[model samples]
Target: MSGGAQADTAGRHGFTPRARLGLTLIAGGAVANIYYNQPLLGLLVGEFGERAALWVPTASLVGYGLGILGLVPLGDTLSRRSLIIGQTLGLAVALLAAALSPNLACLALSSLVIGILASAAQQAVPFAAELAPDATRGSVVGQVMTGLLTGILLARTASGLVGAQYGWRAVFFAAAVVALGMTGIAAATLPKIPQTRPLRYRALMLSILHLVRSQPVLRRSSLSQGLLFASFNAFWATLALLVEAPPFNLTAAGAGMFGVIGVAGAFVAPLSGRFTDRRGPRPMVVAGALFVVAAFAVLWAGGAWSLIAVGLGVLLIDIGLNAALIANQTRVYALVPSARGRINTVLFTVMFVFGAFGAFAGSQAFLMAGWSGVCAVGILLAGAGFLVNVLEPRGA
Candidate 1:
């Protein structure tokens, strides 16, 4: 069946299959920038020293937090098409800078900007929510999120292969090209929908805080998702390091192939969304958190000894994390139809901030205590997420 057949359009303003495909691609491509450095971290350290390598991943995630806080909310205040185009163009520039960087400092700075502009992915998300009717909103979000999540999981593989063949520099140049193409694609495919509201910048930013304070469901969803995201990032941030130096030593590309395997989890989006539409988001969110805790336990118990365990852990974590995210997003988007953009900003800003910390902690843990330390980090974070969901207020 046509992907369009699933989401019944409401009127002239309803979403089209063409737009859905474009947003999916754009979301995938735009977000991939922040993750490109992961598989290349060893190469980066070889040139820039261990201290310098830490900033590479941490800076990208931190910049993503900044971007989500500063730019994504503008979805309610500016044309999403314009915002996407501007961010994509800027992302292209950032990639070029990373490619041309002469020092670790330069590369890290460029990575930060890449992270900031990658919020374009978040823009594509809320834009999807905006155009989708209530009935099929979960389904459409699920489909579009498939692209975003796939881009994220696949980025490591793409960078690992390109970095292995040409060099890390080549990966950034190729990413720059992708960003440039995405700009053109955004121009051609995205509709010029008007802004939802025109609040001043300060008020717009403040509104996010208000939503966080006022909405119990929003708080629980964002915090729970944030903790899970931290666990997910911790695993990715250290996976290359772990595999590169072990009894089962592997090359960069070998380390990255796990991402392809994890694609199994990314494909769950549409199904999870449909499940939410049928059963509600809460049960799905709980199930997802449980999966994460179990994934970490698997990694801790067997990751250091068995490739099968690590692979299984990867599959479980990705499935659990993305499922929770889709359900959490559906919950928030339903809260305020007009403030979808701002609501998303709060969720993602919290999420990426925790992600940044996870990367930092994971790297440090690996340096201090090896694979065991990294697994411990994931377990603690995932446990916290499980607690948050289980302890959610009776009505909240």
Candidate 2:
């Protein structure tokens, strides 16, 4: 299906196959930029050594956080299509830089730039929300998010396969080509929607802070999503260590296969969105939190058993994480129609910052207390998410 036709179907608020394909491609491209660094980390360490490799992913996370705070709000002030196209061009350049970097420091610095420009994905989500009709907004967002999650989960496997066959540099080169193609497609197919108001960059940033402080629904939803994502990040960040150990004794390629298992969550994302649209985000949010907690319990139980059990835990974690994410996004989008970009910026920025922290803490936990420590941390964070929901306004 052509991108424009699919977008038009979404614009009409009906489920069209073309619309699904278009949004999925857009979302996949956007999210892939953020995750392509994961499987490359080991390859990077082999070339650049441990210290620099450790810092490289952190640089990307930092860049992502900064992009959420600085670049995403521009979606409110500028045309989203233009913003996405511009960022896509920047991402292409950054990918090329990453591909050509001679040293660890250069790669790490380039990764930061890649991440900042990759905020295009963040812009894409709100754009999806804007394009979707009110009746199906949640479901549409869910469908788009499925693509995003698929990109994130599958990136590890894709990168590993490609890197193994053609070397690490090839991965970035492929990414650059994809970025360029996506940029052209987005520029041609995306509708030119006007912003609600013309606000100065300074004003837009200020408005984002105000929204965070003033909107009760936004505050609760953001916090809930933030904590949930923290747990999600923690689980994935530490998964390799667990799989590499005695019981599993898996190679990196085997570890990468777990990503394919996690793809189950993408299929579940649209269902979560439909539920959110019908029942409101509250029930989904609550249920999602419980599911995450259950995933941790399953991981704990699977310690001495089959690796299949661990794979099941990963699947549950992905499903719960994606469901909570869509539900929170649906609620936040409902709270501020005029400033979708700014609201999304705040939401994603907070969640990613927590994700970064979770990555760090998970590493520490793994080093200090093994899988049990990782499970403890994940469950505690999930519990905090439950508490956030409990404290939410009764009707909200």
Each candidate's TM vs. the true structure? 0.88, 0.91
Per-residue CA lDDT of model 1 for 83-120, tens digit only, reads: 99999999999999999999999999999999999989
TM-score of 1: 0.88
Best model per TM-score: 2
Candidate 2: segments with Cα more than 4 A from true spot: 1-20, 49-51
Q: Residue by residue across 52-93, what tens digits does model 2's lDDT show?
A: 657777788678778878998887667787888898888899
Show where candidate 1 strays beyond 4 Å: 1-12, 41-52, 102-105, 238-246, 357-377
Cα error of candidate 1 at position 371, Å: 5.0
Colliding pairs, model 1: none
